[model samples]
Target: MTEHPHVNIKRYRLIRTIVIVWMSVIVFAAFLLNIPRINILEHTARNLYFHVPMWFTMMGAVGVSAWHSVQVLRGGSIISDIRAAQAARVGAWFGVLGLATGIVWARFTWYVGSDIWWNFDPRQTMAALQLLIYGAYFVLRSALDDPEKRARLSAAYNLLAFSTVPFLLYVLPRQMASLHPGADGNPAFSEMTDPVMKLVFYPAVIGFIGLFWLLYTQRVRMSWLAYRIQGESKY
Candidate 1:
């Protein structure tokens, strides 16, 4: 029963406080900001604040998961294994949130004409497929009987499947026709845009990122503590 070094109770409290303040700011900004009337149709670009941040935060979580998976494979430490598994779980949760938010945004922005609930947009399809792949990663981890074998196989699969995330999130979306705009080429903030939108958008991104980190770190700490307790009980 080895003690995990990274689990700190005080750090968790600090993260919780930061996330609460960040989320409060995002909510306040969303409510107070004046959404501009872009065309004859009023465009509530405010939704971008929430919608875009979800995807970014999800990607960040998944990236952390992938890194931890690699660490488990290479380091072969139980703490690393626990952290990786917890990271994957958290990342999967955020992935679901991102997909739901993206769908809602799409419905509001582009579902004006067609009765089809989901158009075969490359970005949307790829994002959905990515989520499914990670979901399977969790199921695979659960189905295995041997602990060491489970850790090895799950870590391998996690690293392999992680390659798809960047491709789906960045590459394919840029190459093909996507209803969602490409993030890489264009400036997120432009001088031409309304000052109020910029004010809200930047803070929303920060807030959501803070929220994601807070959750991920908390999950990691809790998982580490559980592993330590289980080991102690076995002795």
Candidate 2:
């Protein structure tokens, strides 16, 4: 049997403390820093620090999930299976947050004065679909009777789901004219996107990704404990 990752209380506590403190600084800097003003983006530009990084965070989660799925398929590690499920669950949470934030940001900026919240933006539609795909992975896992079969099948499903994320979040959105950047010859970089924002923006991405890791590790521990107590998942 593949050895599961050993838990070190000291290490977990240290990492958790670092994540909390790092994100605290990021939140403070994201709001407090002054940035340049522009015609359409104006103050909403600050959202670049919060909204954009959420997708990045979700991407981080996707990477973790897919990595474990690959490991499970190759090594048949039950621990890898647990890790994949928890990562996907957390990743889906980030997708939900990213979608919700995008809607709010668009409502105030692009859809202001219009009675519309869901405008069927391609990225928006695809993101929701991606989350549903992950949701289906969990459902598929729960339905199977055998643990080994469930792990292998769900890992395969995760890989398939992971394949769609980049197309959904990046490639498809770039094909059409949209409110988001990187469309039409990669010219989204404009004067309004201040370089100063990167100070907070980059750190915010790192912080949120770190936060995802912290939560994921915690969930894995709990899931491992429950698995030890019961022969299978406890509902």
Candidate 3:
């Protein structure tokens, strides 16, 4: 079956506008809602709405890359390769945002009076290492001259590297003695019963996820367009 050409600019614009408005409203609500105090737990909780979304989005990007990797390995499709590369680019952006937001949260909640920048915390170290691994994937892609080889090798690397994300985001943090609270430990809100906080927090997550999808679609479309342009020049 032939694919339908259904690139509706109006629909894309409407969806984009809705996502932007939703994000703006969520941010405004987050700022206006008055919490009792700026204690360590409370301050850290604020970062949940921002930092956690970054990490989640990053994972989503990596997942896309992995799916494309599988497609390329199985079918040798250039579209899959293009998608994998685009996803890595987006994932890198989200990873950087996650790290920056984490740093800010760490400064306010963990390093209350200190100026030390690099702590040996497992969460910090593992997250940084994850970023470095993904960065290397880009470097490897640029270093290769053959498109087929680059695609295959990068796909392999993506699969291998993505395996670390779950460990870094979940396992490592839970295993080590860190300033950040573990999933099952104290300060963990596994059983949050507050209706007001839930109302705000759940929407914030959904809004941020929608924003991530909007950006990902735009980036992938641009990448596909660039690929088509390049291909046409040689035809």
The whole-model lDDT of each prediction reads 0.75, 0.84, 0.76
Query: What is the per-residue lDDT of model 3 for residues 1-235, given as tens digits with 9 covering 90 to 100?
Result: 3331333566667888988998898888777776555455574566667777787788888998899998898976777887788887887788899888888778867886797666867788888999999999999888887778888998999999888889987787877777766633535445542455665677777777677667766776776677667762210
Cα lDDT for residue 219, model 3? 71
Distance from true position, residue 14, model 3, in Å? Answer: 3.8
Model 2 stretches astray by more than 4 angstroms: 1-5, 189-192, 233-235
| lDDT per residue (tens digit) for residues 1-235 in model 1 | 4444886667667878987987887888787777767652255566777777787777877788788788888856776777777767777787788788777667766675555568877778988999899989988888886777877898999998888888987887777766666634433336435777877788787887787777777777777667667762210
Rank candidates by lDDT, best first: 2, 3, 1
Best candidate, lDDT-wise?
A: 2
Residue-level lDDT tens digits of model 2 in 129-177:
8888888988898899788888898899999999998888888888976
Q: Which residues of candidate 1, in runs, are more than 4 Å off?
A: 1-5, 40-43, 183-196, 229-235
lDDT for 107 in candidate 1 is: 75
- Displacement of residue 126 (Cα, Å) in model 3 is 0.6
- Model 3 ranges with Cα > 4 A deviation: 1-11, 36-38, 41-44, 183-186, 191-195, 232-235
Q: When superposed on Cα atoms, how far off is each prediction in RMSD? A: 3.7, 2.9, 3.5
Predict model 2's lDDT versus the native: 0.84
* Pick by TM-score: 1 or 2, better one: 2
